[model samples]
Target: MTSKKSDLEAAIDAAARILDSATTIGTLGHIGPDGDAIGSSWGVALSAHKAGKTAVASFGEPFVIPRHFEFLNQEVVVPAKEFPEGLDVVVSCDSASAERLGSLAGAATSAKKIVVIDHHVTNTGFGDVAVVAADASSTAELAYRVLQRLGWPIDADVATCLWTGVVSDTGRFQYSNTSPETLRVAAELLEYGVASDVVGQELYERAPFGYFGVVSAVLGRAELDADLQLVSTALFQEDLDSADITYEETDGLIDLVRLADESDVALLMKSLEPGSVMASLRSRGTIDVAAIAREFGGGGHHNASGFSFDGVPEDALAAVKAELAKQRR
Candidate 1:
């Protein structure tokens, strides 16, 4: 009797075959690509190049690479407009849904084959070959395994990209998602000459002068609802404008807000534009923040999740608080 392959294993096998036969490939990450998204997409693209395939990697509109990830090689990355049309294969990295692909969804949909590599629990499985592993620490880990399975060479630069993804998504291995396997994969990548110190310094240690001002402003108004075990804060456009900061620079602010020992949950709401808000949610261990995000047409892991709102920050906060109230009752 033959044993059935796991969903992830079967998906990887199918993706390898598709990639092996393809002459041209396009890779994309989600909009406002995070370290995991950027690293996974580029890692696969670099690996594809090593295998002697023509590959392009890109993300959706507002295609700015965040300041922290500027060290990554952009050899294969191109603007969405520059991404070749009618590619033989399209691979999406770390995007939970087709909608998250933003302007590039059409490219994936039109491709002869689509491969989805991700670790998000809420992934919609939107590809011909879906390697979705909710248990994996980061999509980069899954990407590493897929490349290894395909017998692709992971050079030092490739390892650096993958290392960034693992470190970022795992919160420097402090998040609950970190497992022995996660550390093992990271160790292997380090063996490939990944500059761990550079990654750590760029990602966590260094920030622009303006960043301190923005942090001060956001922290000043932080609220703690001890009864609900919730700590929350809101950042308006003025906060960024006054500090000469961009919305992207506020990514690490939630980590500070979530440090309140009295609260098990933390929420950060930021103004994207007038009447538009984006939120980041974090939980220490008690709450399933991802379920809350899903209620608002968003999704993520159990501890960290987010959503966008069409209303003012106050209304968004009210809605999230209401949901938390319901959960407690």
Candidate 2:
């Protein structure tokens, strides 16, 4: 077995043992709590709760929590702002690099015993224990597998959380990482009484009125590479302010670009402060968008990724165009 896989297996084992003995546990995901973040946090929390341990799933900013995750509405699962004292273990879920962890990163660093579970490409062994799978699609999927191996068992609520993470991370099974195992996990979660239809509708079938409006405008103006495999669009602050768009509004825009028939890559440009531009990059196949994102001081998964800009959206678009052209061969 590879060292990375071995390390993950060992961490899962240790986590199970911790659950067996720990009294108080704190759990959290990265700042922009996506589906993986929500699912991993809730799945781990629910698992610990099932083991009769006191587990509170902590999240970052309010907007980071997606609307679809309203199903995870629990009184005990709250924000990471007011630190709970005397917790024996603090587990960071679905967060790989500390840089993406926001203010909660300090909490994890200062915890009595910190555990990190994630599926991002940038994990650098940043915890007392690190369980990372860069190719796992979603951290929630890994977390569920861990709990299962620990004999903690997966429940209905846990299944719902797990499914949400998987579904979101895979872009409703549209991403290249979707595999037989992913479908298998989805089937298993269904057996646990997770309403797949509810989760699906919540995730895929709904978008704000402003969301479609912005997408319509972007699509109308999107540029295409010669092969039509690369699509590019620009978004101004005026557009954002007019639609009351938040960072979350850009969540799936990159996905749309990748789906364009002509392009292997998609780029979305946004203006920073006033004169700066931030860019997001998404690609299919073996191209590593994360590396491209790193060039712009942002990082994420290989196929689905993002980056911030140093100038206006137009300038950011120009840089992204150069990068995409450079990758064509």
Score every model by TM-score.
0.97, 0.88
Native-vs-model 2 lDDT?
0.74
Local distance difference test, each candidate: 0.89, 0.74
For residues 48-88, could you state the per-residue lDDT of candidate 2 as single tens digits?
88878888887665425556567664645776676574578
Candidate 1 stretches with Cα past 4 Å from truth are 1-5
Model 1 C-alpha lDDT per residue in residues 81-136, reported as the tens digit of each score: 78776889999999999999898888878888898999998998778888888889
In candidate 2, stretches whose alpha carbon ends up further than 4 angstroms from where it belongs are: 1-5, 62-64, 83-86, 227-229, 244-250, 272-278
Question: Which 10-residue span in candidate 1 carries the lowest summed lDDT?
Answer: 1-10
RMSD of each: 2.3, 2.7
